[model samples]
Target chain A: MSFLSINSIAHIISAIIGTGAATAEEILYFKDIRDGKIDEAEARHLRITYKIMHWSLIILVLTGFGILAGVRIKYGGTKTFYSPVLWAKYTIVLVLLANAVLIAARKMPMKWAGSLSLTSWYAAFALGRITEKTREIKWLADFLSKFNFVELYLITMVCYILAVAIVAIILNYLKKIIIKKQ
Target chain B: MSVLLQFSLISHIFLGLLGIILFYAVLMVLFKPIDFKRIKFLRRVSLLGLISFLSSWILGGYYYVVYYGNIVKPLIKKSAYPWAHSIFMEAKEHIFLFLPFAALVAVLIFYILGEELEQKQAIKKTVIILSSLIVILGAIMALTGIIISGAARLR
Candidate 1:
């Protein structure tokens, strides 16, 4: 395989693992906390998933740099590096890293951070798959380019909050029903 | 690009990335309650961050002085994305100068406080804010670097 292909495969695999771990972490956190607490076993499971996520992140970062370096040498200044979509992905990745730290330190209102963590991984994954030439996604790059980082962050904040709220509310109702039956 | 210029540019960026990581480590340490173990850890990481920032400054400054102005700057200015240099690079060069100083202050704070930094809630909060800014500024600089390179390459 070409070096770029190898690097791309590694990057994509790690991204999938990280995103999956984040999704599972969210579900486990919500369910475990429904009773207002998490047992040692439940917390340990969450920790394990978090560790998995971290390991994936490390691999993703290394392989990502490899791909970027390879592209830089071969493409001789393609717009890929300058794309707004790519930078947006970079921003989301930064948010994910910072959010993980906040969650670990137990600082800040975790609801926003937790919801962001869940939504951002999916957002990043989507962003990665959608390129400037991506047929249906052609408009998205231009649309995303319209705003600066601060504005984009505000938009992401509103979207994630709304999305997580809808899900959390439904989960709350389901848990109530389940408890009533028990 | 000459081999020297390329090496300097890569070294500058790599050091900057390392500095950002170390700044994140410092911020993570500050997020928790201060303690003896944490204080020791903070000292080590902050000092490393300080070194990283200082080293990046020297290397990047060398490139800016010796190579960027002569060759890269003109290319970026004439390129289609002049804003990459005019706006992003303009902001980045100035903002980057702040990092090493900020990191130095953090090192001093850690040096002076030792374990006593735990009791000084106000001081601790100040460090937290400082570290947070460093991380954000570093991230901005990284983004700006991308634009600068992209613009330079456009020619």
Candidate 2:
């Protein structure tokens, strides 16, 4: 396979692993702590999940940069590189990194951090997929193309924040139900 | 750009990233209880972070004005990714100005407060908030740098 193809495969694999690990972490942590108590085993499980997510994130970043560099070198700059969707994805990834740090420091509440982490990973993953398929959807391409960088970013963030809020509420409700069941 | 200028740009980015990482270390340290040993270590790291930020500012500013403005900026502005210049670069350059000052404050807090930080909740919170801001801003700057580099490739 070509360099770009190899890089693309690696990038996709990293994203899948990273986002999957994040989702698993959220679910496992919430499920175990339904009664609002984290036993040693549950804590250990969460830690392992977090380690997976973190390592996957490292791979994702490295491969993502490799893919970006490869594309620029091969294509000499495509509109995909300049897309606001890609920029927004980058911003969300940074937020995820920062959130991870805060979560490590025990500065942010776990639920909030979990919500943000999952939201960011899924958003970035979705955007990456959409950018790949943009050429196949002319209207979608045209629509995204009209948005300036700031407008596109702001809209994406507002949407992501709303999604996080809704997810958090649903998780909270689920936690209550699980607790009641026990 | 010249080879030396390229080296400067690379070093500038490297140091900026290092400074941000160190600031994150400072935040992690401050979040917990403050002991004298940790305080001393935090002070040293904060100083290093400040130095790195200042050094990066000098090198990157030199490159931005000397080479980028005259050469890379025009090319990027003409490329398909002009917003990479008009939006991201503009934001990155302006946001970068806050970093050195934030680093300075972080260094000053650790230097002046030391073990007293454990008892001073308000000041401790201020330090954490500032460090957090530095990390966030630094991350944004790094991503913007990538966009700018990508845009430059079009030329």
Candidate 3:
């Protein structure tokens, strides 16, 4: 395999690990915080989960930069680097990082940040996969070829907002069900 | 690009990255409970972030005005990746203009608030938010720099 392929694989793996760890952390936190109260042991477990997530993030970022550098070195001035999809992916990744920071600081509303985290991670992952596969998929390439990036970005934001609303409603319903069971 | 211009550009990117990393460090530290020792370390890190950001502003500004506009911009414009210049670079440059101010605010907050930051919830939150913004913008700028550099390779 070429150097780029190796880096790409590492990048993808890191992303998967990071996303999985984040998901696990979120689940653990939610499950542990019964009746909006977390005991010391549960809080410690959550902290450990966060630490694992943080390491995964560091690996993800390092491998991501590696892939980017490899691409630049191999392709020189190719349009791949300037693809609107690539830009959108980068923007989503930034949002993910920002959400992580806010979540750490307890500044963001939990439900919104959780939804944003999931949306940003999955969106970035999907975009990356699509960009990689576009070369082999004629219709996908053609569709992306004609799409305006700004419009696509705005559409993505609208979708994420709607997704957050749906998630909030579900969580509320689940909370009520759990309370009723108690 | 001339050797000096290249040096400036590389240094500019490096300093900007350093500033962003230090800002992240500040954020991590801020997220924890602040004590006398941690506050001292936070002060040092914040000052370093301020210096790195200011230096990057000078180096990047010099390169942008002197080399990028005159030399690199035209090359990328003629290349296959003009939007890298028209869109990403344009946004990067404008958003980067905010970093120095944000860094300054962070430094001033640290200087004025000192240990009192532990007690001043409102001011502490403002500093955290501003620091986080700086990190986000810096990360975007770093990524945009890569796109711009790739575009410049067409020449």
Candidate 4:
């Protein structure tokens, strides 16, 4: 197996584990709230979810940069930063990461989980479509093609990160709504 | 394109759209308080999700044979995307296969078992397993695409 394979497989496993842990925590938390056993539920699940999301974000960034670094060495690539798609992706990821931190701090709005999830998924889907289009266009033998697949992938990942942040905001909002109603 | 490939592409796009819709519906249920009415909505959404998920993969398989198997498969050894490497490509293949199985498990758990947080231990476990699988599988698929594209640059 190449070093790329080793790194990718490790990243894949971590992503799966992180998502699984977060999902489990959310399900259990929701169940506890639904059963009016909120107090009975361990408070640790929220912390665990926070930790999972944080570490996953770290892994995602690290792997992304690692891939870029590896490519730089192999291709004798010049560093250029004039990619719109990459910029878009970076902005989205940064915003999303900030939201996740807020969620971990219990400072985000919870009432919007439904909307947040919907929007997040929509953003992710759009990002995927755009990523595909970018690749197709970038590979076009045009003299000044700007939409490379790697850039597109970066944008897509950033979109996903943003979506995650939206979820965190929505979760916070939902919690508030439920609390107020009670 | 061959008939199989054409069918596969259409099916894949259709299923992807349907899955996205169902994903939103599921989110609504999770975020909002569940009432009887919401449960009914959930049932409808889950069933629809199952159909679309199945269709997407059936088409995806066809696409795999036509596009990857015949054309890109042979050329990959020589191709390299900017961030791509050969091993990354192989791992992508593994993820593409495994993620679908994980999705299948999630669909079965959520739709077939009709167990979405009834609060019983078994039901809870089933729902957890289903949701967790979906989340994890989705993440894996996304990551695989990124790495594979990156690795392709090496060729």
Task: Report per-candidate DockQ.
Answer: 0.30, 0.23, 0.32, 0.03
What would you estimate as the lDDT of candidate 2? Answer: 0.81
Give the better candidate number (1 or 2) by TM-score. 1
RMSD after Cα superposition, model 1: 4.0
Which segments of candidate 3 are over 4 A away from where they belong?
A1-7, A34-36, A58-62, B1-15, B31-33, B47-71, B79-114, B119-126, B129-133, B143-147, B150-155
lDDT of 2 by residue, B1-155 (tens): 56667657766866887787788778767778899889998999999999999998998989888888998899899877799999998888788999999888788878887899999999998888899899888877877778788788643
* Top-scoring candidate (DockQ): 3
Instruction: List candidate 4 stretches off by more than 4 Å.
Output: A1-182, B1-7, B82-85, B96-116, B121-129, B146-155
User: Interface RMSD, all models, one decimal each?
Assistant: 2.9, 4.0, 3.8, 11.5
| Candidate 1 Cα deviation (angstroms), residue B41 | 1.4
Q: Is candidate 1 or candidate 4 better by TM-score?
A: 1
The model with the greatest lDDT is 2
Per-residue error (Å), model 4, residue A1: 46
Model 1, B1-155: lDDT tens per residue? 66676667667776787788887878877877888888888999988888888887888889899988897788778878788778888888788889999999999999898888778989988998999899889888877777677666732
Clashing pairs in 1: none
Better-scoring candidate (DockQ), 1 or 2: 1
Q: Which of the CAPRI classes, incorrect, acceptable, medium or high, describes model 4?
A: incorrect
Q: Write the per-residue lDDT of candidate 4 for residues B82-131, one digit (tens) a residue.
A: 33335554565565455445445654654554434454556544554454
Which runs in model 1 stand beyond 4 Å of their true positions?
A1-10, A58-70, A101-107, A132-182
Ranking by TM-score: 1, 3, 2, 4
Better of 3 and 4 by lDDT: 3
- Per-prediction RMSD in angstroms? 4.0, 4.4, 4.4, 14.5
